[model samples]
Target: MRMPEAVTPAEWNKAHEELMAKEKELTRAQDRLAAERRRQPGVRIDAEHGFTGEGGRFSLVDLFEGRRQLIVYHFMFAPGSKRPCSGCSMFVDNLGDPAHLNARDTTLAVVSRAPYPEIAAVREQRGWTVPWYSSFGDGFNEEMGVTVDDNDSFGLSVFIRDDTSVYRTYFTRGRGVEKLGTNWSLLDLTPLGRQETWEDSPEGVPQESPYAWWRLRDEYGD
Candidate 1:
């Protein structure tokens, strides 16, 4: 949504005044957090933890697919686990095209403790082409602390590798939810943005915007 142009000096001043301080604070905090993220201690993967994809088996390094950085979203999708977390489903629902992400020199993939077939079925149903893999065979999901028994929750993590060595760069969950983008950054500027009856949107919430019209990849528009 295009923001209304500030014609008057007062309007422009008011806009900058509203969040200038807060924006500066946010930027500083983000910068510090990113620096700390880059300094995270490495967790080596020595055991045989592999994921199965369409082509064949893939080690954790293989997931990077020769990229400099790898980001894995631990998606909850076990067979007997309670229903898929609506929050995660909603998140993946809004992910921009994988190709867009790929073009950025980063590889984003979903890892689940569920079997390959189960994850594959859900991917097909959701019509998402983003690369997903099953971490069912190995203790990868369990070791990552995302999987508990038959269920798993979501976690965002980054890893890097040079030659044959793998290093965990960063990981975040829960309070880190803000890092996941749902277009709220854009919607927050609108008068009727993200009008989910849930949030206390001061501008009366966005009511059923274009994002709401988005559907699964293979799903047809109504």
Candidate 2:
């Protein structure tokens, strides 16, 4: 084989641009992959998956709560654990009311392996009011592929259904983590918003909300 040619500065710039184009292309392709998965034939939940609901007992279908779309965020909160996954906590911190998603016929819920009693403690500590349910006696988390002992801590997954059928639309982890935040999505609008703090602005920076004003749910009123 012939020896590879050295990359001149000009050639390096060309290569960088080409690589960026391919990155954008790949992002689009991944989005298309999710779309195709959503289009797959829905799967019927024939086996009963148990859960402890506020109203005694409930099954997996009960989790759907009368909606065409369902998004179950598998929160890592096994029994006896003091805190859930920090990365998972970061994603949950970004979530807002499901009403907006509800308007589009989607229902969202956070499922955890912890018993409701333990799960409730954290919910109160975090001041989160999102609909949460316990899967203490069920294999729901394992069946969904989010149950990891110590290796694969947690993951974000989206599921959808129509009538009586359900299907897994998509799931992601690791560097795909950025997909969980709405703040970064907003920062991209301005010339200088991510605050890197050490960042220097040439023509000054945009003003509006002070970053310090943001607070965790538990400390919101304080």
Candidate with maximal lDDT: 1
Instruction: State, as a TM-score between 0 and 1, how close model 1 is to the true structure.
Output: 0.70
RMSD of each: 13.0, 12.5
Clashing pairs in 2: none
CA deviation > 4 Å runs, candidate 1: 1-16, 81-83, 149-151, 182-222
Model 1 CA lDDT for position 155: 78
Residues 1-222, candidate 1: write the lDDT tens digits: 998875798888888888898999997775444434434467876776889876778988889777656778787777555455677777677777544333323577888877787777778888887789988768887888887775667877767666778776566677575457534422222222334444343442224544453445345221
Q: Each prediction's TM-score against the native?
A: 0.70, 0.63
1-222, model 2: which lDDT tens digit per residue? 898688999998999899999999987775444434434444455566888856666766677778555666777788788787787777778887555444334566788888998888788888877777898977777777777553234665555565666666556557655565454322222223333443333244323343543545345431
Worst 10 residues of 2 by lDDT: 184-193
- Top candidate, metric TM-score: 1
Query: How many collisions per candidate?
Result: 6, 0
Query: How close to the true structure is residue 42 of candidate 1, measured as C-alpha lDDT?
Result: 70
